[model samples]
Every structure is written in structure tokens, then in C-alpha cells.
Target: MEAKQFQLAEELRKSIRGIVKTDEPMAKHTTFGIGGPADLYIEPADTDDLAQIIVWLNERQIPWFVLGDGANVLVADKGIRGAVIHMGKPFRKVKIDGEKVIVGSAAKLDKVVSATVDAGLAGLESTAGIPGTIGGAIVMNAGTYRGQIGDVTEKVCVVTTDGVQLEMTPENLQFRYRWSVFQEDKNKIIVEAYLGLKPGNKEELVRTMEYIRHRRNMNLPTVGRSAGCMFKNPDGYSAGQLIDEAGLKGTSIGDAVVADKHANFILNIGKASATEVKELAERVRGTIKGKFDIDLEYEVRIIGDW
Candidate 1:
């Protein structure tokens, strides 16, 4: 490491009270099981640590990314620059107060769903089958055909270099199909969340969850090492349907393959490189456009050296 990089890592560790990993392998962090490494990987112990680290990174003008459960993200083989704040066990906390639930940024979406069901709370049932953290869910307005996180999200807690920004809702943060203000501003990081839900029968909610799970099992490629959903649905057409119609399902480049079950999902069949996956994704997009004449927009965030 260079003197400047070493100093930055030292300063980051000093500023935050948490685990700080120097030159950490990002392949282990992401769900795709790809990526090279991050110069500095941090996991803040609490909200205070999270706040302090953001401030420090900004002061040094060092680039940093807030990584949640690493779903819906594609990091390059050359890796990311500066630091990566990994939201993990240290920050994963969920507090339930009647119909209101306060969830930490690192809290898993599945766990939150199960908790709400156990508590006999409705509204969060729509998030059943979605992967990744609550912070990620809120940032991307994660949802299914039945409902979205925006429907129940009362307030979103965020942190930036300036300090902690509090209580943001769909009313303030434009929620659209798989998008929110968090994507527009990389500097603003989602930390905690407050969701207001309605009361419902536990048995009914469980049934709803089961039905959603069944749909997901039959449709999405959940068995392999892959990032969920490569492209966003274009208006009336589904991206998966377009790819399947193009007959590119089960197409392969190196070890990466377009899942036969879901064309929108690029699975790492075994030991696939980032370059191969990216190339296959680009090719899939090109083929779909050539056949349909409609451009497809990517939903997953592609970061780091390309």
C-alpha cells in the first residue's frame, strides 16, 4: 500500500469504533462471489461510528461506498477504490413497537419479514422473497408484483458526511419502480428505517408469504451464485420475457450463463470472472434490442473498475 492509502486506513480506524479490514477481498463480501478487493473495508459498531467514518472519508476526499448485503451489485475484477463500509452483524438490529418497526441498515430483509409475520403485522408481507438488507430494500424501493417497500415505509434514516439525516418518506423521496433518491445521490447513505404496518391475521399473512415464495421459486433463479435481476422491466414488457423471447436463455460465456429459468439472471455456473459476466450481460442486452428494438435499462448497480 502507498503511504497515502495506509494513512487513510489508519485515520478511518481511528475515527470509527469498529472492525476495519485493510485490503480485504470483496469476492467474499458480494453475493455474486466476484470482485477483486477493497482497499479498506469497514463495519461500524454503531450509528456514531458510521457517522464519524463518513465525515472522515469526506474530509480526506477519499472515495467510499456503503455496501449492504451485496445483492443487486456488480463490482469489477479490478475492485473498488478507497474504502467500503460493509453493513454487517454489528449494525443489524430490529425493534418492534406494536405496528411500527425500526430496522437497522444491516438487518436482513427475510428476517424482517419473518419478524413482522410473527408479530402479526401486515404490509411488510410484500417484501417476502426479496434478498439483501432493509437499507438496500428501502434505497431501491424493493418490491414484488403485489406490493413494494414504499407502501409501508413511513420514514427512512440516512447518514452523510454532514451528519445523520432523519425521517425521510416516499412523500419526500420519490419512489418509483425499483428506484429512490438514494440511487440519485451516492453520497447519501441509508442507515436505519421506520416502517408503519397494519394489523393482520398471522395465518393469512403466512399464506400470502407462502404464495409469494412459490411464485419466486418457480420464476427467479434462486439456486445459483448470481445477482438478482440484471435489467429493469420496460413499461409493459418484462425484461426476462424479452430475453427469453430472444432465445438467449441458457447462453454461456466462460463460466457465466444466462439462467434457463430466468433470462434476466446471469448465474455464475462455477468460477465465473467479472469480465465474462459483464460481457454476457452486454451481449444479452444487444440481442434483446436487436430483436425487439426497445432499449433495456439495467436495475443492478455496476461499480468499481470496468
Candidate 2:
């Protein structure tokens, strides 16, 4: 490590109450089982500590990236520079207040769904079986055909890059199909969110959640190392269906293969490199475009130093 980088890591360790590691392997954190090492990996103790850490990094002009459950991203083989911040256990609390649900950003989506169902709150059933953290769900506006997180989100507590905390309303969030303001602004970090839900029968909510889970299992690739859906649905068509119709399923480049079960998913069958997966994805896109003249957009984020 350079003198400047070493100095920054040592100073950060003393200043914040969080877990800090240098040259941490990114493969251990992501679901795809890929990626190289991160220069600095941090897990903030709490919202206050997270805010402090962000401020310090900003002041130093050091770049950082936030990692949630690591469900929808592809990290490069060259790894990430600077820092990677994870919310950790401290940010996994869920509080139920009558018809409102206050959940920390690091909380898992399925756990929050279960909590709401148990409390007779009916809003998050559509997100059952979805992978990743609440913060990731909010950033991506995660959803199914039934509903989205944006539908019940009233507001969220966020820390700006300047160390200022603010509660932003839904209007400020600007949630659309798989898009949010957070996606555009890397400096704005979510702490927690308030969801307003309606009272419903617990039994009915449970049934709905179960049904959603069943549907997802039936269609999604279940037995592989993957980063969820590879491509977003086109305006009037499903990306999976298009790939399926194009007979691109089971296509392979190195160890990266198009999932047989779900054409939209690209599976890391073995020791697939990031470059291999990206090349396979590009090939799929080219084939689809040539056949149908429709371009496919990636839903999975490709990140790191490439």
C-alpha cells in the first residue's frame, strides 16, 4: 500500500467505531462469487458511524461504494479501489408501529416482509422471495407484477455526502421502474425508511406471500451462482422471454452460461471471470438484436476497477 493509503486506513480505524479491513476480498461479499479485492472494506457500527465515515472519506476526496446484499451486481476482476462500505448488523433492525413499518436499510427484504405479515400489515407481499437488502430494494424500486417498494414507501432517512441527515419524501425519491434518485446520486446513502401500509388479514397476507414465492421459484433460476436477472424488460416485452424465443438459453462462454431455467439469468457455472460473463452477455444482446431488432438493457450493475 502507498504511504497515503496506509495513513488513511490507520486514521479511519481510530476515528470510527466500525469493522475495517485492508485488501479485503470482494468475492466473499458478493453473491456471484466473483470479483477481486477491495482496497478498504468497512462495516459501520450504526447510522451515526456511517455518517461520520462518509464525511471523512468525502473530506479526503477518497471514492467509496456502498454494498448491500450484493444480489444485483457484477464486480470486475480488477477489484475495487478506495473503499466499500457495508451496512452490517447494526442496520438490520425492524420496528413495527401500528400501520407503519420502520426498517433499517441493511435489513433483508424477506425478513421485513415476514414482519409486516405477522403484524397484519399488507404492503410488502409482492417482494417475497426477493434477494438483497431494503436499501438495495429501495434504490432499485424492487418489485414484481403485484406491487413495488415505492408503493408503500412514505419517506426515508438518508445521510448526504456532507454528513447531513435528512428525511426525504417519496416525491424526492422519484421512484420509477427499477430506478430511484439514489441510483443517480452515489453520495446519498439510505439509513432507514418508513413504509405506510394498510391493515389486512394475516392469513390472507401469508397466502399471498407464499403464492408470490411459488411463482418466483417456478420461473427464476434456483440452482446456480448468479446475480439475479441479467437484463431489464423492454417496453412491451419480457427480456427472459425474448432470450428464450431467440434460443439463447444454455449458451456458454468460458464458465459463464445463459441459465436454462431463466433466459434472463447468466449463471457463473464455475470459475467464470468478469470478462467472460460480460462477453457472453454482449453476445446474447447481439443475437437478440439481430433476430428481433430490439436492444436489451442490463439490470445487473457491472462495477469495480475495469
Best by the lDDT measure = 2
Put down candidate 2 lDDT per residue, 61-151, tens digits, no spaces.
8799999989988999988998999887999999999999999999999999999998889989999999999999999899977889999
- Among residues 3 or more apart in sequence or in different chains, the pairs in candidate 1 whose N, CA or C atoms overlap within 3 Å are none
lDDT of 1 by residue, 128-244 (tens): 978899888877889977788888888888887776766677777788899888898777778788889999999999998888888888878866788798999999998999999
TM-score of 2: 0.97
Backbone clash pairs for candidate 2 read: none
RMSD for each of the candidates: 1.3, 1.1
Alpha carbon lDDT at 168, candidate 1: 76
Give the Cα-based TM-score of candidate 1 against the true structure: 0.96
Which model scores highest in TM-score?
A: 2
**Candidate 2 wrong stretches, greater than 4 Å:** 2-4
